[model samples]
Target: MTVPVRPDARRNATPYLYGREAAAVARVLESGQYGHSDVTEQFERRVANWLGVPEAVSVSSGTAALHAAFLAAGVGPGDEVVVPSMTFCATIQAILATGATPRFVDIDPDTLCVTGDLLMEAVTDATAAVAPVLFGGRAVDLSSVQGEFDRRGIVVVEDAAHAFGSRDGSRPVGAGGTALTCFSFGPIKNLTCGQGGMVIPRSPQEAERLRRLRLLGVVQSQNERADITTYHVDSFGLRYQLSSINAAIGLAQLDRFATTERVRRRLWRAYRQALAQVDGVTLVDVDVDRAVPHLCQVRVPRRDEVFAELRARGIGVGVHYPPNHRQPAFAAWRRSLPATERAGAEILSLPFHQHLTRDDIDHVASELERALKTTGGS
Candidate 1:
């Protein structure tokens, strides 16, 4: 797991920077407002309006966003949160941070999302919430399970880290009124704010609580940066406030959506066309025109072999996940997830970013065929 630092072999495997990102940082630096300030509030308002949400609470990271949402939802010791095993470990860790149990659930194999049926079967009297992820930026089909979640009174905390710009028909992913929806602005995510996240809260009350939780539970306003002598602490909180500098970069990235999304769409379409009937390889319906993808992954029979082959040939391939249930640290939370286990073994994420050229797409596709041949895959 320890990859030696190889500065010389740097690969642009994630969403690369647009020209204005540095300027954004510089503006924040020169303003001398490094702490959480008006710029942070401005970014939150823009994000909330963009998502059509009443309140958007900006935080330190996507994991922190998830943690804050869980706490706001009252998920604590002894409560169970049903989550898909086919997701990042952050989902499990976020729940654990609240002293709650994470119940691993299998995906629907086809959509690679936890279906309403699977979710229904996983819950119990102790179930407090279900955090469904928009995996690889694929929109989760919530239609089937929305009724059940309402009837059961289970809070839906959508993990929309990958679904930042994705839309459902005409509605944006985070705009829906869920208990909470989290977005990431990590270095590798579609939108980068150095390292930050934003949570679209269901109510103004929850929004206020999240703001308090992010700054050591000290209930204070942004204007209090000038007069911090007076404040009140209600309960436990953490130092999870996103700096103004980070928020500036995020604001800049939001402005670049028009150009950045186009590059992603073009390259993603190129990959889709090039790999169209490769024998043993299967791709999810990325619908790049509609969804802004964070990764372009495929399911290949000899995935490990293919993963190694591509990387050996200077192609930066990756694995989106190794099922949460299979992790030794989360052994106590283990449960049988056949589809998740099988998919984890076969999933392969190819190098995807605005930096990739059409030639790069062809090369990756051609090399995939070569790898499949050597591994005895059709």
Candidate 2:
């Protein structure tokens, strides 16, 4: 098949850098105090202000953020965390890191997110927490069953790695002050910090707990530790602190978040409009009006064949995930999650990033339609 090349569509996802990122990193490099310095704290404060939250704790990675949140919430051995099977493996790994088993739940296939009803059905007496994956940057609202969770003393920790700038109703995802929301500033996420994460805690106490957890249980700041001969370890923790280098990149990215938000939404909508003309393709809704969408995905017939065909044509099509419940590593806790399994087989993530143009979206949609027809899907 002769397919016209689209260079922009050759990348599934790439960081969109504002001009200042290089200079920011240069400054951090020159400072020589890279490990969790004042710059890291500044980035946390800036993020909290942007999210309209009281505190945001910086971490080394999204997995570390999840691990810290699980530990801070008192989730441990003999406990179960309710989570969607459609999320990244890191979410499941984080649960296991806490010595807790994951009670895999199904998602609303259209949104690729676990609904309150699904989570409620999966919760048992052994359930210690519920970690909802905000797939494709769409916020998962668990408000309908909040009272039940409260009554049962079940903590809500959100794996909002894809939802950094998304909104739930009038407020941003982390600003709700309900769940312990985590955001990733990975290379391809809406905002790039090269690699870093943040946890938005519900209260000052939880914020302190997260801070301590990221810094290997140390109660003193780096400067304070330098002044004192000895530092105190208050609890069990990990070396998950976000370094000044990563924080510098994040701070620069944050300075241009409004542009990032606008560009991402526009790119997502372009894909939506173009994909509409392709038969047998169901665009997984991201609630784009309120979301700074992180991925443009679709449920297509013969997804594997379509994925292969797109790749052959140099279109950057990929799968968001294969259901975690079906993975061998998580076999012991796996259950029959019909919705998640079905979506796993059919979902395809298209090239999504700030770098793609409207023309790139059109080319991807056109090539997708052709691939579907060639695969006897349309």
Best by TM-score: 2
Off by over 4 Å in 2: none
lDDT of 2: 0.92
lDDT by residue (tens digit), candidate 2, 130-198: 999999999988899999999999999999999998999999999988799988888888888999998
Give candidate 2's error at residue 198 in angstroms.
Answer: 0.6
Query: What is model 1's C-alpha RMSD?
Result: 3.3
What residue runs in model 1 are displaced by over 4 Å at the alpha carbon? 1-12
Q: Judged by lDDT, which candidate is best? A: 2
Where's the lowest-lDDT run of ten residues in candidate 1?
Answer: 1-10
Clashes of each: 0, 0
lDDT for 207 in candidate 2 is 89
